[model samples]
Target chain A: MRNFFVLAFVALTALALPSVAMAQSAATSAASDGNTSGVITVIQVDSETNLVGFVLSTQNGELVEVSVNDSTSFGLENAAGDRWVSDFGEDPTEALLRITDQRERFAPVTVTVADGVASAVVDREQGDLERNLGFLFAIYIVTWAGFFAYIFIVSRRQSDLAREIKALTSQVG
Target chain B: MAALPKIRLIWLGFTAALMALTLWMVFLWVPTEINQGNIQRALYFHVPVAWTAMVAIVLIAVASVAYLKTRDEKWDRLAVAGAETGVIFAALMLITGMVWAKPVWGVWWTGEAKLTTTLILFFIYVAYLMFRAYFPPGEQRRRLAAIIGLIGAIDTPIIYYGAQLWERAHPSAVVGPYSNNDSSVDGPVGLTLLVATIAFSVLFVYVASERYRLRKQEDEVMALRRAISLQALRVATTSDSTESISSAPAGGA
Candidate 1:
């Protein structure tokens, strides 16, 4: 009777898993477009002029380059009361830019371009396969260490018991 | 004792039925996947075997805890049986997974989470069996085995969740919808896998139970033989002592 119940329960669970998996898959498929909407703002600081400008990149891949005096493009009128001003000068050899999202979260990305290259190359330092391999190696070491430790403890216990058994036999004799 | 025979028969029947169903579902009912072709069929056995191996580790953990609490040899027996069974299934899972991977993953084996962890688990259980085989039957041996079993069982979840944790710690290769998709996410293929897992689990339980019963029986027979031999030695010692006393009397006369 117990065996029958176990079998029945297993069958029911087995029957139910497919439906659950299908529902999960359906939910995933519905949201599979993978479009994530977030604001990106870039603030470039020129050490030579001590001036800052902002660039915004949207989720739809639209890049909006805004200068300090460009108020009409931002739906604002140029007024004397405004503190914004643009300083037109020679391009600095180096620019330090901090890119922030709409929420003001900043990420540092350095862009470099070679001569006659149409595309600027961006580099972001992130975790890679070597780091993962290091983790795997750590796990392997810990697992083997624990395994050998257990073996050592077990062997010690066995020898201790054997000594105790010999002592008891000696007393009996 | 009266219920033992019935349980054995039921276990035998259950295993036979599960094996048949598994064969039918895997070979006939489950359709070959279009993307992976016939080779993907190995998932039917591989996944279930891995699942059963995990289940066996859990059982070993439970038995280990019970042995520690109760200090009973029976729990040790069960733990040994579970570990041995787990090792077998783990090996099968590794081999079958390799066979499936050769065509799909383009390598027979790689140090991936599933493969490496399963390999570690396999070695742990193999060590557990060796521990049992080397030790004589006693409370000390049982206690030692129980401790090892508990420790080995702790590695199961580490192996399982390692990949997820690894992904979170590392940069994902492909950042798209298909990146996180499990290979067994299809409808018919998922159903076939479910059936196979169930069948394999049931078979695993049946085999482990039978092996435990055999171990228990073997222990009992060994105990009985030891008792009989001790009794025979006692009888021989008494007869020798009486003969010595008689010879002393003859020497005095």
Candidate 2:
């Protein structure tokens, strides 16, 4: 029995290893693209100048300073390459200020840099940390609730089984 | 039989202590991730459930194969329990994953290879459970379920490597042989992950064993019921024969 489990483990591990190279290549492609995908570390809007400045932590871990002007368009995109216009208005400074006001710092945003300037800043869905934390809390509650529910079900079934056994024993006696 | 009393208490205490400590480490000991912050803390439990699901399904497949070879009811019981517990864990895994994805990936779900394949795996085990219950307990039921268990096991590797095999929104493995050094999330995060994994793994064992014992008791009850019905039939047959013999005219005449 022990050997059987060991064999199964080894077989499963062996099958999974072949895909490592493929994953490595994909990661390489995704990580090297700092111009487009990165986490927003800081968003600063200069009300006096109507300009925006933000720090982006690229997938490769390099932090880049991005400057945005009124021309930059805001939008959202997902994994399927599907994208849409953002709720934020066209003004880059206003959008940055709104994002700051909403406290959505450290969320991923798609930035299109052209000639060392941010041409587009897209909010990828609800990137607000507080909103995401609600989902996190929901996840935890659902998980623990599901677990306890399962235990309750098993306990109930056990009770039913015990009762049936008792009735059977009595019948036999 | 239920878990031995002494061992059961020890396991309960240990599991509770480990779980409490993991919760402490997750909320207090570990600092919020500089990048993802508090939402990222979900990883401590999410990753461990995923790992336990993988391990449980693997055991189910192996037990199924052993049952096929040996024809032992014990193996069948083990497989059933493993698969049942596996389904619960996989279900939790998918739920937590989707919750995590919404925050990090900016959507509730993605057709990203890893997420999709894991969903597929979850459904397969669920189907396995339904298939087993649909049939009466017998050779046919066991054999069919064993076959499904083996097939379901094949999905484990596919799910594990899906993210690696395709470029998707799902992040690459943080801690494993396949993890790119740059991709791994560690430090306090890593420590919490370790503690959570150990705690969940123990919980899996405890639950699986309880499920196994329940299955065994159920089988025994079923067998006893069958025996009683057969014996009652025999007694009724004997009594009817005696009544007819006694009611007939004297045999000597």
Compose the digit string of candidate 1's lDDT tens values, residues B1-253: 5896797677657865875576566545665443333444556767788898889989999999999999878888888878877887787777766655433433356556777788888888898889888998788888888888888877677766886576467533221111222665568777778877887787777667756765665675556566667877998999999989999989999
Quote the TM-score that chain A achieves in each candidate.
0.32, 0.42
Q: Give candidate 1 regions above 4 Å deviation.
A: A1-173, B1-3, B159-181, B184-186
Write model 1 residue lDDT over A1-173, tens digit each, in one string. Answer: 33443564456345434533343333322321212222335565566544244454544576544333211111000122221111123222122221222125433221111231112111111111122222322322332233234334433544455455555445444
lDDT tens per residue, model 2, A117-147: 7765655333344565567667766777676
Pairs of residues clashing in candidate 1: none
Highest lDDT model number: 2
Accuracy of chain B in candidate 2 (TM-score): 0.88
Taking the candidates in order, what DockQ does each have? 0.02, 0.18
Q: Which stretches of candidate 2 lie over 4 Å from their true place?
A: A1-116, B1-3, B158-183, B250-253
